[model samples]
Target chain A: MKVPCAIVGSGNIGTDLMYKLRRSPVLDLVLVAGIDPASDGLRRARGLGIEATVRGIEPILEDPASYPIVFEATSAWVHRQNAPRLEEAGARVVDLTPAKLGPLVVPPVNLDVHLGAPNVNLITCGGQATVPIVAAVARVAPVPYAEIVSTVASRSAGPGTRQNIDEFTKTTSSALAEVGGADTGKAIMILNPAEPPILMRNTVFCALGEGYDADAVAGSIVAMVDEVAAYVPGYRLKADPVFERDTYTTPGGTVPARVVVLLEVEGAGDYFPPYAGNLDIMTASAVRVGESLARELWRAAGLSERDGARDGARDGARA
Target chain B: MSASGKTGEGGRPAFRLTDSTLRDGSHAVAHRFTREQVRTVVAALDRAGVPVIEVTHGDGLGGSSFNYGFSATDEMELVREAVATATRAKIAVLMLPGIGVKEDINRVAEVGATVARIATHCTEADISEQHIKLAKSLGMEAVGFLMMAHMIEPGRLLEQARLMESYGADCVYVVDSAGAMTIDDARRRVAALRAGLSIQVGLHAHNNLSLAVANSLAALEEGADQLDGCTTGLGAGAGNCPTELLVAVCAKSGIETGIDPLRMMDAAEEAVRPIRPDQGVIDRDAIVLGYAGVYGSFLLHSKRAAERYGVDAKDILLELGRRKMVGGQEDMIIDVALELARERAG
Candidate 1:
């Protein structure tokens, strides 16, 4: 028996997931939900030969009377609004927002725990990307301090990200503490709306308090990131900058800045390579986590729709 | 009487003034100062007790649109020639934030160069700190320069100042290389640089809007002892506060400038004389840049926009600097210029 699933948003991320799921074997697509009448989700559903329904939050929450699972792709606040309704109706929900309605998940760190939970929430994007690196750091160097700077395209960033700037810090810290095993990671995130958009979440300056196996630590971090990215998708590593320079004018004169370097290592060593690898691993892990949620939502809904038609055909033959 | 009620150079002071002609001033001319002319000016600044002669590389580490021409010069020869009768006065060189390593820095410091100024722009303080630390580590008399001081407040500038000072900066300079500051602002900036840092404060003025002399003098009066000058005011955007004027102002007032003022004027004429006609003279665009306190980088920017979007350079420069430019619109200016080029190309 297939579990009826509902995809509650048809935005960029949602649409991409739908195509991926319809082609996959594990899950069925049942209901495609949306908030706007003008969403491409409705048109896409029709193109996929899936049922087209008008958009509303109430309809999606009510869907579990038939569709018994929900994938919430709304903002954190909206997830909070829809969480209890979906859970009480006996539908397990997976949320894409930073809001933690239930257990937070990343496949490498908590895959089994997430599968076991009736409702699961993926923490902030930074949590998904940097947790593995943090775990790696603890294994080899054991840190007293860590910070990640996840600069994003401002337009692509979710709502409440800018208006509530403090929330970005709070959410990042809370998520890092939960995953890193020490409630002490800081996040300084920026939304650079620069042209020719750069998509990189760079983590810098992880000071590891001495005593541990740094090579083993880096390996573990890389493994976790690779594992998560394999299961999910869309996470990739970018460049590492060391000895960065620019021109600065001071009261004295215009002096050229010839060397500025920040290094992250799991041990007492000071260099740029360790932190560069750490940042790449962590970011890749987080992006994959998001990818996995999309896959699950699309599969469950599509399979459940198929199951419904099959049941109807069998009933007619028996009659 | 000057606008400040006195020639703001109103000071009795004793210090060798160094005009960064053909060096820091290279940015005004697109870093292609003719070889003969560069040699003439560098030699002249040395002849005058302007003492330290600084040469090219306005933006270090591939930071600028082009590299400085000094790469072609035999650096050792250039250094020796610029400081013929080496007194305590030295040949100074500058670098941008990310271009060279500690080994490279030590090499420059060893090759007859006494001071190496490493710089970072205002928004890049967090990015600039580590480089300055490296320069200090190399045992170079490292001076950290923060550009576009007008865009940032005194307090925020102080935080960076203190850090550079902590990293062993012998001097931290406030650079109005943009020429966008008033005399009062210069004083406040000088105070800010000295407030939290133990290092001495230096002032490098750009002669945009004819305010360089006033601002530099104001900075000196407000406790800045280290200052930058250029012979014949040959520098970026209008140029620098004149070495001759500073020395004369210092000398006529019975101030103790070790520099010989008359010697500096003679050097200026010698350096100002015609070189190969193929190498252009003081530019018209740089003059306009000084009058408006705008960067003389408009031409380079246009050239870039042209390459990026395949449009003509002249149009991009004109539209980008039009009224839409702001107090700190460096990033926006480039973006708009590129956009204009794209639009025209289409």
Candidate 2:
């Protein structure tokens, strides 16, 4: 049987998740829940013939058996309240907000490690864009300080993003340390209002300690970009990593061996325009996590791989 | 030649002109401005009675790295030359908080950069607090630049501008970095900022949509105190507002700018115009970029990406606008072009 999933928000990220979920073979998106009756997202979901509700999570709360997995794209404050309720009802949760209530997950870096957790938090967009590069650099060298600057189109930044600016920087920086394996991390976001809005560009500055292999670090970063590209096809490097032998003057003193890498994420025009790589990376990774979780649940239950596909086929035949 | 400040209905102040020939004008010359070139532009602008002359790489201070092309000469050397040559105009440096740090500010200030334009994305003004404070501490006139102002509503822009004002900015600018705003957009934002902040408000415009001059005038009528321009509209994308044109307009409108329009025209035609790669005019790429509300700096990057990916540049710009991409997302050009090429291939 195909795993039934419900998306618990009908914003850009949630609606994008619904479209990607349609392409997944393992999970079926049954309902989209939101509080806004006249939202474009709700209209789009209804147009797609999915059961969408403006009553928020009540629909899913009442019919827990129908939704075994839930994707919470609401704000952190909302998720903080809804997560426990979903867990009580025996539904797995993928929290897409900056809520750190669950174990942090980045599909390419550490998704598999938190598979069994009741709730998994996909960090902020900046975290999704830069942490992998930090992880890739840390794989080869001990990164003492890693700083990421993410510049996205201002139009791509929604009201939620504007209000949560502080939380985004704090969460992304923390994820850089906890998940990206950095001693200290700093995150800065720039919303470019340039016409033909600029694509999502990320600049990664990693301070490598002595006795580190530069070539190995480059190789690892390339490999990691490919890994992320598996899900986000537009994720690629603008140029080879640039290295400078310079001293960084900190509040304490000076540090050496600074390597800077520039990355650009082009979204796969799924639901957002291709320039919304920030949104793309988040939703794309969520799909990766959802599909993997679906497969994991199937295996644990001794269900065959073809069983889910067969169920989807039977559903399509019935429809 | 009108240096007289004719009072408005409510005695609103006249606009101050900031000549950006050495800074934004670099894009017109492919960011290869020599120290002598900067000195020449600075001297002429100062002699023409422009009050402020911004000098830095086209992308701002510390933007001379590989990602944003390497300058023909070092920026510090150029700053020194500008300081040595300008007679009356205050020297300024544009510093995005991350790209240009405290040390960069100190270096420029030490060499006599009297104004520091601390720029950040419109919604992220909090990040500019430190830089703005540092500029004030250094005794430099600090201006907050809310880049991509078209991306937010007037109330939101006012909030960001208030944060900059709270952080010690003497003036706050509504920067149309993409030249995408209509006259009403500029008027609404300037009016909001005027009502909200006690500090002075400025306007910066790009000519991507052929509305730079009109938007600047709109903002001026709505209580803008400072305006930025480049000689001959020689800057990024379709370039900035033409300095001579703005001065001429101010004169015609009986609003004093203390600038000689004839001198500005001489500077544009005799000095800056010869070195320009192409005169600033609204082309197809620039038009689409303006219509789609894309960043102005992405024009060249988009064109190159389109050529490399074998797709139409307009298609790339339209797709970028559809996605609501911003200034630093140059990499998406290639992604959009590739996607377009793929669709054609299939």
Candidate 3:
């Protein structure tokens, strides 16, 4: 028996998930609903012989029996309005909006809880990157305050992100609340207006409570970052550098971050590098976390159960 | 009646604090600040007891005329507008001679400025004569701004300071435009400015070294009479001594800065809102650019070059920096070539 799944909003993520879904033996690639028929993702899905339609997105969410599971990958505002309707109809919703309507999920960390939910909110690319660091930091320190500076090439953030920029604070906090606890959290987001946008990058500054050695804290941060990065493919620390004060330049001409590590020790410069590296590591982790949540939900939607029967066919491509 | 106290000669704080944001920060965003923002900033500075503000760009028209420096607004309008708004703060305007010498001095006075600064690169200052003399003739308080104080020899800077003083300038500013100078370097430059000239000495610090406060404090300790700052350290690359840091440090050290150092928080929040990048900010790149002895604006160029070349932005920056590329110098290879020519001549 095929576990039927519908792909909603055939954008980049929706299409990629569609391709992955078609390859699964247990899941029926039932219908692809796109707001824009001309979107390249829908075109590609149509070419692959997957059922595709546009504009009347309601058809997929009209009844749960039509498609047992729905992947909501539209703009933030769109997802905020669409996710509830899909969930109410009894189809479990996997939302890809950066909006915080329900819970934000970074799979490997929050998989146990969200996998059982009727509706799950996936963190934004930035949230996916930083949530793990929040988890890692909470493991070692009594965090009183945390601040994140997330800079991305303007191009990397979509229109949904821009519209929900302010809510990024609430959305990120909700994700962090699930795993990494902080007394107070602050995020400063920047979008570079560069004509040809650069890759997404972020920097985090965290202040742990009393009796904490910021340097040791920074070390713990690096280890935890390494843990999360391991889960995040294509994300690696660009530099393992000893940053000097205010000179964030590395030996390889990479900008060595300027930092003044504040410890109870007063004017200490020791904790800056590991702290800097951890920020980068955590930020990349956030992107992977978002993707991981999407994959996990689809698997639990019973595709894996069906994949088992056709194991011989998928075994060759399992890797 | 003094805003802070009795205005009996030398009673309120010797020199007023001036935020050179629109002027120096213009180096970062190409002086994109609107007239309305400028007016608000001047009002905020006025409320803070900042008595002098430099409205710049030599008729606001300098930058690379046929090339790529910050082309300022019309000198008269830029100065007059600020002067009209901040009646208490002396309206001061800056002009880079030869860049705007012919059109500036008389127009600066016409625009209602009370003080005019004549700017020149110490590496090439002989050509600034006509502009400096014109400011003096107009009876405006004349100032000579010598940029990139590190790139030029100390002795040469002293000579230039002496020349500006002799040419009837009221003050000489040692601008560590790169924010690269150490406290020691700042002290030496300030001392040199003071020792060689009868006019007051000033320091315009950048945060490239993250030492704007340290350097400015050193200059003051060494007897420099004037200092420059900004709202939220929001100028070019890394920004300058945060106006708050300067005031706070000065207050903590017993120097009389009539402005409330705390008001800086208000200023910082106001000025940095529009300019901050999305996502990661005031982070590693800022710290690195500070250490490299340059402004943050250059990073935009490096980032551009990196994206275009599909290589590392940091590599692009180092290559540009090895040649001493100034932040506002977009066609900077030419400036590097000029430096080469000067080195050969020397």
Candidate 4:
């Protein structure tokens, strides 16, 4: 009963997603596609006994109906080119690039809203990490301005991330508004080169409108952290959300009150090292979204819950 | 200009001086540079025969944010004013790869900025490749700026410089961002870059340790083709090497910078000094910044946070240094202050 899926782009993010997809219960990874024949990610997939191709999206295009879902982990430029073709072929895309081809999705925030969309953009890793917190605060009161700073180890950022740094900032900042529910959003990323590379860390600053209860806001943030942690086990607050008044200065004006939240994300060590939580959160969130889509596809086909359970049992026996 | 200190066809040791009074000085003033201020500074520098004048937010393009202080005037407006005022000088803008996106560079270029200085931390030069290439493709002079050069050795810095050279940089700079380098430190880094990079080498020194002038001289001896200075040393932390002082020294050392030293001094005294109350002096806090090897722009932010939270700014600086915080981590100033306040209260 597992929905068959394919992954395109054999880079750090694609390779990492490959490892996560293998453990997914509702989705089966059928193919990994890349342009470079000698790419380490493609070679690693072959060694894992999974089907991998150097033809990029050609293999998936040949038999598009088989892949109900295709995860695009390539660069934003490449995703822009592949997105329309993948959609015409009738495969739902979970885009991990900064290419904002469809509605942005943060699993805990708006996954259910975009389940029926042909494609869903995960924004950038920074957006995935900080948007939920902004949504949490916004749920209590309107956020006038929200700014996030994401610091990751230099070693964890491949050449793709380095070259597309502009797109990363723009997409993440826009998501802070479009997904995180802020009037204005600013994003900054830092590549830390400290020896013994540091875990991915984020600082989210939100400027709130008038008459919001601080206690209610703090409670909302705490609850949201728990929900995100349910999928991303290593996602946790480095410090409690620090509330202050009249500290943040936005383009509109100086805000009356603000809250600061610090977060550290440690990877699941699926493919990259533990410090590469930037990549981990994207793949983890993708898996969460892909599973939801698979469940919906099953329901659309009039499949019963018992069928899923029986299929799981059979797969377990085989293992 | 040659790395061997050879005299050019003009019959004197060739050297270039870039004035950064409008850009780095924004940090000392908390990033509140008015358009009039920018125009005045640019006019003064241009009149004094400065070949390059850099103008941007203190942290670079797109730096006006909640973390970094906001500019009083939009940076593009200020750049326009500088461009309109300067006749002899080519205008430059600083763009940190992560903080400032390509759109910011495009905007600056559209506003007539001819030079783009793409900056990164000393060890993170890989991030500057795209921006450097973009600048070059835009037909602008691209310079790779490596900040916090004192944190890494000369050999490692040269490796980073090599990365920038491979990215098509017109020149590479050994920037003592913390102002912690001594004469030897400056000499060795400039020498390494000059020896390793086929492109030109530049030096950007600060006066935190009161060695800005001496270090600039050492860099000159190592054949640094370009050097940055500010009018009256009006820049971040203890300010930068004073443009007037650097020109005077270069003249005394038999170097031809094509700048009028007396006009530069007059600009500092009449145009620059009156706008700011204090000269960029080597104060205790600034010295602590150098001693701790913290980013120079953190000075005012740390001081304000420490004062607001009722903690020691020096202690905050030392902790930031211990954590190896680089530039663009200005938000951590308030975080460190809050942590210290909680510790004291508990």
Candidate 5:
């Protein structure tokens, strides 16, 4: 029994998420909602035979129990307005915006902790790409400072991304500290306009505390990249993480050792082009979180995994 | 030349001057501008009839970080000092969209910064909309700054500038951040903006190709309403157009700038020259910055990386230019240098 899921705001992100949800085994995409009647995303969803609405989140609100999960792919401002209403309707929200209405979840790092959360905030594209690596290093040794620079192609940045550039930096930075286990964090984003738009690139810099084992840090980072790649197939390290004894001056004091990780994310070409890895990683992570939430819901209702699969097979046979 | 005859009251050219010694010059000095230096410079520029004085980190607000070098004194402290010292000049601050945020704008506004020059890469003006609107909402004059303007053609640049204008930018600038534009490059861009934009058009030139003043003259001939300069040309790369020289030239060319050239010269020599003894010379690395079409702020960082990695700084610059690196990608300097070193070893 795949739980029903809906996506709000049929913009670039929402449209992309629609394509990714088609491949999910545990979640069924029921609705694609947007306020604009002439939205291409809603039209595309309808063409795919999926129910889409022009009434925004009202369709999900009218029959809230039908949608056990909803992905909010709208702007931060719009998500803030829709979050409380969605919660009142008892729908689990996987917020793709930087609204930060609930606990932040980077799937590999803290999805288990926030499994029962009513709303799980995927911080930003930059946060999703770099936080796991920061968490990996933090797991090996204390991270005094972590900074990230996310450069994406200009063509991939729609109006929503452009408007939330500030939120992207702030939310990503805080997630680096709170979820990535850094004492202080900073984030920078760049919109590169090179012709034949460049792939999404991120550089993660972490200042390590004293007595850090280099081998342990490297092993942890490689393992984390594999775990993230299990969902985001195109996510990979550009090269080995560079470890050096470099000095970093933070607001607190100087940090002795540093680790630099370079990452490139190529989209799976679900809806957008391959250069839009920034969007791909977000939707992929949201799907992973939604599936986890669905399993949790089944458990809470006293149904085992084998029983749910048997019921899904029986329902398929009936159809 | 006929456009040079356009004048405001008192027979002065209808042009405003913004001195950037305290802001862009920070990059040349490694972001080590003390509060006293800001005070002295702001006081001198204010007394010399400079209409505006911009003070901030070279990379703008929230720029003090591990990627970009940290400021010696807090940028807010420097902003406060500049605001307190300036009596006649309106204080301005630079806010790159991705490097800085709305909170940075609010903080600068609270400290009496009346003008917010919101900057972005030449092709990415769409990202400046929110910040520009925020600045205008805070009752600050928002200027759209297009850095590295040579990377795009005039028609496309006009389209980007139009986005800023629609977002409530009071003025827009044609910034040669890499000091790479020729005189015609500067002219066509300023002409395109002046012809297209209803808002004011400004030109910011760097002297890497030895064309900062020539390009400023071309912009003036094309009806540019504003021009930026640094006292003694103390800025990144080959520095900016020297304020003292620009004023003296304007005074001699029968163009009225409403600025006392002698006072400006006094400010440059007495206030700014002592800070950097060999300021603004178009040396080899500075020339390479223009030749490679790389960012001006990358000059110092590239040199440091080259020295540490035992590779050529010019090679690092050319590679960065080849990669089409933008303003906020300063972290790539070390990455590029490391790759070059590895290649050399291999």
Candidate 6:
């Protein structure tokens, strides 16, 4: 059985998510809605035989049974207002905005923990790329603080992202602590304007507890990269983990024994250019979450293990 | 005598002054500006009536790392001390969006930094909107800086400046980070920005071609509303436009900077010059780097790479220029130098 999903906000991110769902096994994309009927995204979705609307969430509310899951891809401000209404309609929400009214989820790190949540916030793209690594380090040794700097091509950021800059930083930073298990977290984003746009590059600085073994931390981080790569095929480490012994004395105070990891995420060319690893990670991770949630609903609806295996065999045979 | 006093070439536009001695000068000291040095220099600049003083790693905020030379003292500590020392001047920081984040800006603001100059490449002003908006929301005076302004033409520069203005930059700067722009280049870009943008226009010049002061004058003639200078011309790659020289020139030309030239000279000669590794002068290396349109910040990295690989720094810089490498690609310096050394050996 396929769980029905609808995408609101037919912009770059929402449209991209629609394209990705075309290949999903369990989630059926039924509607692509936006504020602009003339938007290219809505036009494209209509051409693809998906129900496209400009009326926004009211239609989804009128026919809530058609969409069991709604992907909220609007700006953070819009999401803050729409989230409660969607919950009242009894539809699970996958928020792409930084409004973050729901529990934050990074597929590789904590998707299962928040699978039952009514709304799951994907956090920022930077959070998706770096949080798992932070979690891996936290598992090995105590991480007092973690900081990540995400650099992406300027051309990739849309106006909505440009407007919600504060929410982006605040949500990404808080998720590092709340989801990655870091004591404290800070996030920075850079938009590179090079002629040939650069790939998404991230620098993660984790302040490890004194006496933590460098090898163990590196080992755990490398393993975590592999797991994230299972969903985000473009995820990889730019270089081996570098250990630095230094005292960083800020006006706030001093931080000691820092371990730095440099990461680069090359996009899979799903709906954006290969350099748009920031967008790719979000869509890819959302698919993983959506599939898992669809499976859970199927099980809760009395679909047995044999039935799941039968569905898988039928899909395999059809392919 | 008002802090907001405006005086320019024809007594029309009132220009503001920002001092970069402690910030950009950190490059000359190998990023090792002591807390005491920051305290003393900021105090002197403040007394000299400079309106704004930028404080951060020479490359910008969050630049203290192994790749970029580590700062001798923490930048936030330097920021706090600079803030405490200044009485009239508003403390500012140079933040390249990728290098520093909102948290860093908030931390500096908490310590009393009231201004943020968000910088981007000339064509990439759109990237600065988020950061600039954040700065304005935090109640800081936000400025947009377009680095390597010589790389593009006036019409395009105006478009980028307009984008920044829409994003809430109080002012926009055409940065000759390589000190490569001639007087005409400065005039054309500043004129375009003045004509097209409703917001204020500014200029940041280097002295690699010994044209920092002259280029700055030309920009002011084109109605540039703000200018940057470093004490004793202390900054990256032949340093910045000398603050004392700019003040003296403005005075003689009947333009007002609201700063006393004599007092600025005392600060430059007594407080700044003593600690300088070298005065800002157009040496052969700086000339070549500027001639090739390479970034001013790349000089130290190229020099270090040349030393490590036993290659000529001049050849490395020229090759980097030919490759059209921009800032943040410092890793390529050593790679290019190594190739040059291999070719020489062959």
Runs in model 2 lying further than 4 Å from the true structure? A1-222, A225-319, B1-13
Interface RMSD of each: 13.7, 7.0, 19.1, 1.4, 1.2, 4.5
Candidate 2 residue lDDT tens string, B66-94: 33444777788999999999888889999
Per-residue CA lDDT of model 4 for A1-319, tens digit only, reads 6788999999889999999988877788889999998899999999988898989998888999889899999988999999999999999999998888899999999999999999998988899999999999999988988999999998998888887788888888988998999998999999888878889989998887678899999999999999989888899987788887764568646778878898899999988999999999999999999988988888888887668656755663554
What root-mean-square deviation over C-alphas does model 1 reach? 16.7
| lDDT of each residue in B108-213, candidate 5, tens digit only | 9999999999999998998999999999999999999999999999999999999999999999999999999999999999999999999999999999998999
For model 5, the superposed segments whose C-alpha errors exceed 4 Å read A35-37, A55-65, A244-247, A306-319, B1-14
DockQ of 5: 0.66
User: Candidate 5, A142: how far from true, in Å?
Assistant: 2.2
lDDT digits (tens) for residues A57-142 of candidate 5? 89889999999899999978999999999999999999998889999999999999999889999999999999999999999898
Q: Tens-digit lDDT track for model 6 on A256-298?
A: 6777777889988866999999999998888888888877777
Would you list the rank order by lDDT, best first?
A: 5, 4, 6, 2, 3, 1
Native contact fraction per model? 0.00, 0.13, 0.00, 0.60, 0.67, 0.21
**TM-score of model 6 (CA atoms):** 0.84
Residue runs of model 4 more than 4 Å from their true location after superposition: A35-49, A247-249, A304-310, A313-317, B1-13
Which scores greater on lDDT, model 1 or model 3?
3
Q: For residues A223-288, what per-residue lDDT tens digits would candidate 2 score against the true structure?
A: 999999998889999767756655554211245776777889999888899999999999988988
**Model 3 ranges with Cα > 4 A deviation:** A1-319, B1-11, B57-60, B64-66, B69-77, B271-290, B295-297, B325-328, B333-346
Write one digit per residue (lDDT tens) for candidate 1, span B195-219: 6677788888877667777887787
Ranking by DockQ: 5, 4, 6, 2, 1, 3
Docking category for candidate 2? incorrect
Write down the worst ten-residue block by lDDT for model 5 chain B.
B1-10
Ranking by TM-score: 4, 5, 6, 2, 1, 3
CA lDDT, every prediction? 0.55, 0.82, 0.58, 0.89, 0.91, 0.83
TM-score of every model?
A: 0.49, 0.60, 0.46, 0.94, 0.93, 0.84
Which CAPRI level is candidate 4?
medium
Root-mean-square deviation per candidate: 16.7, 9.6, 19.5, 2.4, 2.6, 4.7
Error of 3 at A69 (Å): 93
DockQ for every prediction shown: 0.03, 0.09, 0.01, 0.61, 0.66, 0.19
